[model samples]
Target: MTDIATKPDSIIAVERWNTFWGARDLEGMKTVAADDFIQWHATVRKNLTKDEEFDMLVEALKVMQITFKNICLTPMNNDTVLQQCVADIAIEGAGTRNDVPFAMVFHTRGQKITKCEEYMDGMSLPPIEFTPQD
Candidate 1:
């Protein structure tokens, strides 16, 4: 990972996050995130970091699913951070997570996410991958 505390790279991480999240590729997600990455859901005071986040992500992906659409990024600053563009995500169960906007603040040192704070609604997500088996 390169120093994200610098410009461009911080921006890159923003892109990486959206890509990895959309795919739900655990291994791929790991590559861009810092070993001690931290995420704070603005709605909740609880904080998650390191293995906790990874474990949660893996477990969530097991029954959790989401498709990211119309993802765009707005730079909050030159190197410090940016805001995710508004989007309408199609969640299998909870209906469309529409016009749902999120704010991502990055604390980076390399081309990796050392720490992150994501703001999103806490509405219950529907059972993921509810694809019916024929």
Candidate 2:
């Protein structure tokens, strides 16, 4: 893992984002997120706030696990970064699916991520038997 202190705020934010998913560190995810953080799933026409997303993750983890591979991060500016990766999703009963392409643009302010726009093939995700809480 890269040292957060040595990197710029954008880089630190993206690093923590990757760490959160790759390591399933939910608490670590909170540290780099802004209070008003939002994630947009453009393809699915869905949006999630920081708290909503975290709650979804809590439920999702019970039936599936995600790991990232071949991660590439490009700093678009001081406050934005483009991240691309192949995610391996292991669903408890559905079996593991590898090389599912995923991409996101992270917007950050200081050490906190303010927003993320994600792009992925929704159909490629293996079905999991978990219902999100209301």
Candidate 3:
């Protein structure tokens, strides 16, 4: 496994994270995230720690059968990166699927992400036609 911290640019860390998720490699997540990483998700309405966030994401990946496409990654500065992507979520229980567009901002210190904030349409949960099965 390549060490995430060895990368000279913060954007590389974000790219590595994308690759890990695309491959569904849970162990690779540890390399790109700081031990104390925090994630603030708009849909969740709460801040989650590194483990909590990844655990929840893993569950979502299974139940939602998520697939990502049309991703746009930008390096805003040395410490920040921005991402825009479309996520297709399968809600088999609701007998529906939704294509949602979302944006995220990643804050990095060195090559590990320290914080992440995600923005999407929602009130309490995602503002989509299908209800979350979980």
How well does each candidate superpose onto the true structure, as a TM-score?
0.70, 0.85, 0.78
Consecutive 10-residue window with the lowest summed lDDT within model 1: 125-134
Model 2 clash pairs are: none
Model 1 lDDT per residue over 61-122, tens place: 56545555556555555355756655555543456656666667776656787877777665
Comparing 1 and 2 on TM-score, the stronger one: 2
Positional deviation of residue 124's Cα in model 3 after best superposition, in angstroms: 10
Best by lDDT, which number? 2
What are the root-mean-square deviations of the candidates from the true structure over C-alphas? 6.8, 2.8, 5.1
lDDT of 3 by residue, 102-131 (tens): 898999987788988988775423343322
lDDT of 2 by residue, 1-134 (tens): 65666677798778877888678888988888899998887545577889887887798888887788899988887589999998887888788888989999999998799999988887776554443333
Could you arrange the candidates by lDDT from highest to lowest?
Answer: 2, 3, 1
Model 3: per-residue Cα lDDT at residue 117: 94
Q: Give the TM-score of candidate 1.
A: 0.70
CA deviation > 4 Å runs, candidate 1: 1-7, 87-96, 123-134
Tell me the deviation in Å of residue 82 in model 1. 1.6
lDDT of 2: 0.81
